[model samples]
Target: MKICFITLGDIKSIATMKRALGMANPLQALGWDVSIIALDSEENRSRISIECNENVQVHYYKDCSAKEEVAIKTRLVNQICPDFIYFCSFSFRNRIIKSKLKHKPKILIEHSELASSIPDNKGPKKIALRLLEYYSVYYADGLLCASRYLEREYHKMARQLMKKRLPILYSPYAFNNDVIDAARILQQELNERYKNNTVLLYMGTMTRNYGLFTMLQAVEQVTKQKPDIKLLLLGRGRHLEEAKTYVQQHGLEPYVEFKGYTPENELSSYFDRADAFISPLNDTVQDWARCPSKIYMYIPFRKPIFTSKIGEPKEIFGDDGHYFNTNQPDTLSKLIAALADGRLQKTDVNIDEHSWDQRAVDFTNWISAQYAVRFAAAGSEVFS
Candidate 1:
């Protein structure tokens, strides 16, 4: 079987790229030809490095303008004629690609919370984009969701468009084991620097939606009892400066370290040194359906987790760690107190269910089966 992935972002270090590559690796191992065609941007082009693996080819179609992008994509589809095309993140380019390729089975995968994430986005431009998103989702041959909550929202939206059901599949975000190893190395190095303090690591982009400020607040509260609580924050974002200022003003310079944006290959060591992974996500409408990919990385270390009860976190990490009230610094402080006393269980969450290799194998098998059924029904010759 031949599978081609169509993605929204430049196929670089983003979770979209990671998950696609994770899925592709297993399919390729099983004798399937997998290729990724990404919308190349200067930002991603400069950073993306994918060594050509056997049975897998990564292609980037570079067109700065949207019109040129569509043309480039159309040409690639015509040339490749892949049996299956998985679209990650809805786009106008997908409409063009679907129209140009009459026979290819297109699958749309949504990773974020779409509907309630756009309540105030009711202007003409927002409405137009939502309509496009809705249409692409409703018309796809198959729909894949990263979270069950998001799947429920997707079903509700599809029903509004007279679509009762979509051939929906579940695919959560995941990391390559190689990347996990790198995080372990970084963790050891950070462990040496912070000496005695337990490093509470938070990876991924630091932003308002991700609850970075609340983490800082939790740090301030925890320091009084557990002065040895050191925070190692990775990744950069719009809210980095604000978080920095908060750390400085609260006299947390000795306790908090902002190790901004490490490369993908050099992250596992950090995961190794982490005593706990913290994500204080709130119960906003946006947070309800979203699944942050960081939890997957945090789990492989088997370190205890500290997070708010939002989205799939509760379902995935139930009783494995401590859960705090979103936006409540007091509750976070209480959790920290319990942590110092070894009250929270350090047991591993059952991430065997969320393993990247398992997820990839399942998805590839289902895709192959679906394609076989379609081919047989259409009276096409099947290959042994």
Candidate 2:
């Protein structure tokens, strides 16, 4: 079957981009054709080759007005003529989907974070998003749940609106196979550089929702006892200036450093170099909705993973992850200190078991089974 992935974000800059790329190679191996459409960054539309193989065709248009953008998407939709169109987040196919595509391809929404869960989205904006989300959830042919919370909540949501249950595919973030060798090479370099320090790594958006300030606060507390401890933050977001200010006010300049958005290719090395991984998510609705993409990415390295005890990570990680019940920075401070002091132990996670290739295999098998079931009930005419 041919599937087209439509993303509204810049190429390789969002979760959906990675989700599409992670499953592409495996899907292709299983006799599925893949194509990608990027709505933002005209330069990146053509450069999709950098991330995907030459076999995967790409589509996009140059800078244009909103009306022109809609026209371009409509034309591109007809040209590809895919059996399925997979997308994610707020905008429906980056804010445009055919009134009806040529093939009537199925729509799969890979849920990330919902606006209602966000603290900033309040009043009329939140209500509007709820309406949009309600329509999007029921309108799609199926859902691709990123977190356990989303899968459970949205499944119930869909059931409340319709008699038939919507098809679901649980595809969380997985490690990149391509980065293994590069990560190994970079690990040795990082080992030599941070030999004398307690290095903890964090990679994600620099927003309040992701717990940027909470992480820095933990670093500030840790620095009091372990002056040489280091927290390397990779990625920049809206809270970058605020994070810097927190570090400065607390005199954590020596302990905390912002590395700024590291690309996907270079991330694995940084992962290997860290003594532990830090993802301080609050016990908020947004946190519950997300799968903690960084947590899955960190597992491959088999390093100590530190996160909140709430949601799916606690259930999935088990002994593998260090969990904290409190949102207090002091609670995290103790854990970091324990790991750095060799008190808290590291657990090994089977990399092959959680690799993207493995996830893709499960994802494809489920998809194939779903198609077979559909064909059996609707009589092959459904597939066409």
Q: Write the per-residue lDDT of candidate 1 for residues 127-204, one digit (tens) a residue.
A: 786677678666687777888787787778778877765666767776566555443545556667766777788887
Model 1 C-alpha lDDT versus the unseen true structure: 0.69
| Candidate 1 local Cα displacement, residue 218, angstroms | 0.9
Q: Write the per-residue lDDT of candidate 2 for residues 1-384, one digit (tens) a residue.
A: 678877666643665677776677766766677887765574354335545687877776665676666567767878988787787554633545557456677777778766677778899888887877777776788888877888887887788788256887766778766656554556678888888899999888888767787788887888888887899999888889988988888788888889996655567778777888888777888888877777877877778888887776765676567876445888888888898789997666677876778886786667767765222221132342
lDDT of each: 0.69, 0.74
The global Cα lDDT (0 to 1) of model 2 is: 0.74
Q: Least accurate stretch of 10 residues (summed lDDT) in model 2?
A: 373-382
Residue 289 accuracy (lDDT) in model 1? 71
Q: Which candidate number would show the highest TM-score if scored against the true structure?
A: 2
